[model samples]
Target: MGESVKYYVLLILRGMAMGAADVVPGVSGGTIAFITGIYEELLDSIRKIGPNTLKALLNEGIPGAWRQCNGAFLASIFGGIAISMVSFARMITWALENHPILVWSFFFGLVAASVVYIFRQLTSVSWREIMALAIGLGLAVFVSVARPVALPDYWWVVMLSGSVAICAMILPGISGSFILLLIGIYPVFIGAIESFNLPLIASFLLGCGVGLLAFSHVLSWLLKHYHNVTLALLTGFLMGSLNVIWPWKQILETTVDRHGEVIPLVQQNILPLTYESLIGLPSQLWPAIGVMFLGLFLVLGLEAISNNMSRCE
Candidate 1:
């Protein structure tokens, strides 16, 4: 492949990784963007889509606006995300249902390794960074433990929820799907996607676009002005979010979805032995460990490959 094609292909692959991550409620695609070294560029590109882009479109036509907004890059990343999410959603959902421990264990490893990967990005050790990390961690933990609320049965509420979820999705530690779950709209959103609910999808996408445009500017500014502190906060977030992906959990509450199937809406993390005793299911400890290691190594390997690629470039 040519150089540009190769680069876009790399982006697509990265997007695929992000999409896969986003499929699981406890994982954030933004974490994948950070791992792949595209987080800032993604923000910059998204932030460029405003008045200037409009001016470019009017004066210089589609090409100018496309160039202004880094259309190719955005398209490649989002295309990959779309394709991967569609492909992996079913598999991940099935795994979560049939083998919850293994699925959560694998993601636990991924996130754990991710914590190290993110922490290494810090330039210096200081109190501000530490405090930020503490705050982020506390906030993430609070969100994880918070009770789920009923999604308001209104079009505007759906749109508003989408906006909030999209913002959470771009934060390295926060899971957008988890946000949906918190509002009791996860199943509704998922069903809409699966069944092709056009109006609902349109409203959600509109909210996403608006949220992206507004949030990117602030995030980009923060990264530029407060790089280390921001990263520290994100690292803290990643650390605190581990609770969401803990391998062994006892369901504290359940609810019936639109499909009339009972699903867990509230759960408490538990030990493997405790899980076996209380849930009366095999802990699957050894296998979970194996899968967890696979996830950890997979992240480290991706980082190594990305570093090598950067050096070669």
Candidate 2:
């Protein structure tokens, strides 16, 4: 019993790490899962909750279906994610508001290390794989810099946003919330969460369910058949995502939110000295660099531990 409790607790901690990563704009929960050695398992579990599992529920009963779907594992991981999102939403928001540069610097380092880590997974490199990497890198860079579209507040739009965002959530270098922000529904979704808008939440969740089921199957298939190319592409994605998280930036455009607060909409990356000269901000160069190193080492340490455990097992 104690062993069971201990195992589940560890799962919860992994989920928490995922949740924290998801909260960051340029980070991905899937990155956490990958680092923690649960990426494939998580994908498999998600993929199982489809037609076969439903059929099992009807034919063999709840126990069989639950077992087939790995219900306990899913529950533990998702429960931790939910808890972390709810618990840290406001705190993360506050941190972003007050310490944007430092926050971005940390995630920037995290993703830079992630690119190297993911790249090492490739056993061989080919021209086609290199092309795939370029494509992925281009796509990520484009998405990172693309301007936000003003989406309507309609239910369908919200649902579509959720569907798309959840896909990004599961990708190693793409961020779901950042996708939402790009589509101009991030504030609305955040507001919905804060207000407990049941209908909006339901619609969004429905979209997420559909998206996750569909995307996981496609991803699982690709990983099974074309592992090298896929990893190459994902590594490229991490490489391009660095542009999104660069620490020093100048806001080129701003928009008024619902609260009438001016929020940065478009930004240009700049050197620390340039940022100081142009924006007249303190730049916080030393602190940001320190945090960046902390994030880099954190990923390295986790990778070392994961490797050690694999060897022991």
Query: RMSD in angstroms, all models?
Result: 1.2, 1.4
TM for every model, in the order presented, reads 0.97, 0.96
lDDT tens per residue, model 1, 84-197? 877887788788889888988998998899999999999997999999999999999999999988766466777898899888889998998898889988777776766778
Quality of model 1 by C-alpha lDDT: 0.89
lDDT (C-alpha, whole model) for all candidates: 0.89, 0.87
Cα deviation of 289, candidate 1, in Å: 0.8
Backbone clash total for model 1 is 0
What is the alpha-carbon RMSD of candidate 2 to the true structure? 1.4
Q: Which of the numbered candidates is closest to the native, going by highest lDDT?
A: 1
Q: In model 1, which residue pairs have backbone atoms overlapping below 3 Å?
A: none
lDDT by residue for model 2 (176-214), tens: 888988888888887777677888888888998899999
Residue 295 in model 2: lDDT = 90
Give the range of the ten consecutive residues with the poorest summed lDDT in model 1: 149-158
